[model samples]
Target: MKEQSRRLGEDSIGSLMARLSIPAFIGMFVMGMYNIVDTIFVSYGVGPNGVAALSIAFPVQMILMAMAAMFGIGGASIISRSLGAGEQKTANTVFHQVIWLVIFSSLLIAILTFIFIDPLITMFGAPAEIHQMTKEFLEIILLGAVFQSFGMGMNNIVRSEGNAKTAMLTMIISAVINMILNPIFIMGLDMGVRGSALATLIAQAIGAAWLLFYFLSGKSTLSLKGFGLRIDVKLGLRIIAIGFPSFIMMASGSVVTIAVNWMLQIYGGTMAIAAFGVANRIASFAIMPINGVTQGMQPIVGFNYGSKQFGRVSHSVKLGMLVATILSLIAFAVAEIFPAELARIFSSDPVLIAESEEALRIMLLAAPTIGFQIVCGGLYQALGKARISFIISLMRQIICLVPLLLILPNFFGLSGVWYAFPIADFLAFSVCVVILSTTWRKVFRETEMVR
Candidate 1:
């Protein structure tokens, strides 16, 4: 374990990326597949309204994930850097604190979600027609929210300790279990949308259990011992500060989804919302591999940066960005070529098929540029530049996308809604290039002077 973990600071960039990224990609692919599977089973079993209900429930779920990211991504950065600096005790402390934080924060979120279940769903743009179904789905989902949050948070820590395959297994096992159970619960048992939520809960619980066991068994570099549940105020604050950008990045997704849902409700009604849901799922699937690439790069970048190996850090980021861009281009091709066919897989409804086809194409038009934007944000996060990372993340979703969503729709209606994504993608892409180039140049100069 010590040797494997040490290689994060020693391995060649290409070799480390290959070793780390492939598993992360598979794990992320499975993560993305969960939604695709749910949409397929739920649409066939419970119909289009069921699809809309899941759509309305998505933003709330994103918020839950945001909470996880805040702890997981935040703490992992600390853990990786600590390991790089040869401070195993500090890394252990961060791990234990992360677990405690995830547990507490998730429980709090679950309670609040349950308390405002009705209002929250309504606020998420659940149309009157599908409001009841949306509530039912969200209710069951919230019950298992803690498991989802904890499992996701722990997975990042596992990877940071240089156990990428283990982290990948956590997601794979959960997704496979969810896929198998979803059909049985939703169709055979006649549980409908609630069944889908239940399946997710059970799967997440299993994944969480596996992670907790791994850390507790003395198998990890950072174990679940030597630190009490009570968090150190100073350390806890640092974790939150570093992770806050991830929280906002994910929360911004929730905000964007809600805004889009409301506009769809106003302009195109429930069917439009359903179509957007299909597009969203496909888009998420496309992005997940790119996300996995950045994730693979995170430990590498954080460790190298901490060890002050600026050259290695630079190499890793550029390679990751190139791989991510290639993946995004492939996704773009799939979106453009098979838009209608992909939509039809989710629903047999003709109108939804047509609507989703168009939306999918427009939304992914600038996907070729999206990889650079995301990679840059991930690089910032790895370098512990949370404020810059937060800005880049916010710009893509809130700063650029939201205002354009509002104005463009006023002029072009539904078409304008479709156009907003590519416009934001281009704008965010430009910003990322400027920021990355300027920062990297400074780092290179500093390293030269030090030499």
Candidate 2:
């Protein structure tokens, strides 16, 4: 067995988690920071409209990311398990398949996006004032879709092999490049929102190049030399099946965003959408550490479960949930205490800041429950239980939130839109508790049998 794979099955859960998660936490946090920084620069450079344009353009970006997540995440699950089971060949094959799949899918999406840029932007609920800017920003961003997809997809593969530091370095490098370039392009060059898009494109391209080098230089546990690049139909199908839940989660998020944007348009106009855009960014940033924990937990759970180390699997899950809850509580406190201060980081406009503060506090009202819900969904995914994971993924956005979003505004006005978030979060948390409790014993009973 390779050293990395063995470490995953043997390492102390607490120390291993810290080793893996801390890098992922730092990387995801910095990666998220660039987005925040991008917004800050745009908010200052071109004003509230620029920030609103980003919000409108965000759903389409989510669609592109959904494709990457589907392949990356799905492939990572297989690779980690295959490694644990001593199937190196299978891991290499999946890696190559992910590469080809990401390239093909991203290119296809980008071309289609370019062709339908105008109507697509409008469909995302872009108001008249920001529609043109949204279109321009998206156009430049699409130019680098393949780069973004490659980097995102391969980063998962790197982590699956237990090279968390490499994965971390990839994001850190990209984010640093992006932050340095954002001000120069947006303010110095006077390029506005388009410049923000351009800087992101360059950073993604560099990140992709770094991953490509890592694989080609024989640094990865999965080698490229002996593997045929042909896609195995059955294996590819499995990858898609496993990853479909992640795809659904993200794609549904895009749908939810579009729905929310339309609702905001109806009730609160352009400024409300801008506020949502900012507040959403802040919320996403706060949740990054939880995401990092889940990412760290995935490989450990997959490896141990594959090797039938059920005790470690249970331990990892419990520890992950505990840590995630702590992080979420911190986020909740921060959002409650300093909504306006957080809002001010993006824009100085009194109206926009005030709107953002209200939205942030309201939307994150169930913040304490968020970590549990997120980790539960991720746990199922790591276990390769796609069906259960898919159901869990659906509960928050499609089942609970969407219905609330559609029904609430009629009775409560714009505030209804904000209320939908926390309500869904709490409901999802309730369901997760029930599911985890019912299934917990059955999942680990086999461990007792083995003993």
> Model 2, range 105-215, lDDT digits (tens) per residue?
999999999999999989999999999999889999999999999998999889898889989999999999999999999999999998999999999999999999998
The local distance difference test score of each candidate is 0.90, 0.91
* Local error of candidate 2 at residue 402 (angstroms): 1.1
Off by over 4 Å in 2: 227-229, 445-451
Per-residue error for 439 in candidate 1, Å, reads 1.5
Lowest-lDDT window of 10 residues in candidate 1?
Answer: 442-451
Task: Put down candidate 1 lDDT per residue, 1-451, tens digits, no spaces.
Answer: 3876899988899999988889999999998999899899998999888988999999889988998999899999999999998998889889888988998988998899889888888899888889999988888888888899999899999888778998999999999999999999999999999999999999999999998888778778887666676778898889988888899989999999998998888888898898998999999999999999999999999998878888788889889999999999999999999999999899988999999999999999999998898889888888888888888888889999999988888989998888999999999999988887677676557556322
TM-score of each: 0.98, 0.98
Residue-level lDDT for 159 in candidate 1: 85
Quick one: best lDDT, which candidate? Answer: 2
In candidate 1, stretches whose alpha carbon ends up further than 4 angstroms from where it belongs are: 444-451
